[model samples]
Target: MSGDRKEVVKLLAEFSTIGMSVAFSIFIGVGIGYFLDHKVFAGRTSPWLTLIFLGFGVAAAFKNLYLMSRRKDL
Candidate 1:
């Protein structure tokens, strides 16, 4: 019963962190993209880099989730 309870707690922690991980990943990607667009690209293109990197961030988040769920030691 103690083991089961530990597992439940672990699962709760994991599930709670999933949302935050995804959000932070996307935010970081967007931040980088925004920097690149304004500071690096400089009016050559606006919003395109941000959009592209945001998509990449979303993909990376899902990939993290996929790998996490696949891990047996989780």
Candidate 2:
């Protein structure tokens, strides 16, 4: 019983991180794009890089979701 409870708790903890992981992934992507566009290109690229990176971020988030859903433990 104790072992089962422990496993449940561990799994719950892992599941709870999904949201944070997704958000952080997106934020990091946007941050990188913003840095590149503004700092590296000096406003020449403007919103294009930001939008492109945002799409990448969203794709990454979905990929994370897909992987999580496919977890055997779940």
Candidate 3:
């Protein structure tokens, strides 16, 4: 029973952080994209970098989620 409870707790912790990790990854990507677009690039390319990086962020999030879900122990 204790072992089962520990497994459950581990699952709960993993699930709880999933959304946050994805969100944080996305936000960090966007922040970098935004900085490059507006400050580094001087808004010359405008939204292109932002959009590209945003897509990358989404892809990374999904990839991370997939890896997390594939964990055997969890």
Reference-based TM-score of each model: 0.75, 0.90, 0.84
lDDT for each candidate structure: 0.88, 0.92, 0.88
The residue ranges of model 2 lying beyond 4 angstroms of the native Cα positions read: none
Which pairs of residues collide in candidate 1? none
How would the candidate models be sorted by lDDT, starting from the highest? 2, 3, 1
Tens-digit lDDT track of model 3 for 1-74? 69889889878987998889899889978888999999999999879999888888888899999998788864
Better of 2 and 3 by TM-score: 2
Q: Which candidate gets the maximum lDDT versus the true structure?
A: 2
Query: Positional deviation of 54 in candidate 3, in angstroms?
Result: 0.2
Q: Which sections of candidate 3 miss by over 4 Å?
A: none
Better of 1 and 3 by TM-score: 3
The predictions' CA RMSDs to the true structure, in order, are 2.2, 1.3, 1.7
lDDT of 2: 0.92
| Clashes per candidate (backbone, < 3 Å) | 0, 0, 0
Q: List, residue by residue over 1-74, the lDDT tens digit for candidate 1.
A: 69989999988987898889999989988988888889999957789998998988888899889988898876
Q: Which residue pairs in candidate 2 have backbone atoms (N, alpha carbon, C) closer than 3 angstroms, thus clashing?
A: none
Our model 1 lands, by Cα RMSD against the true structure, at 2.2
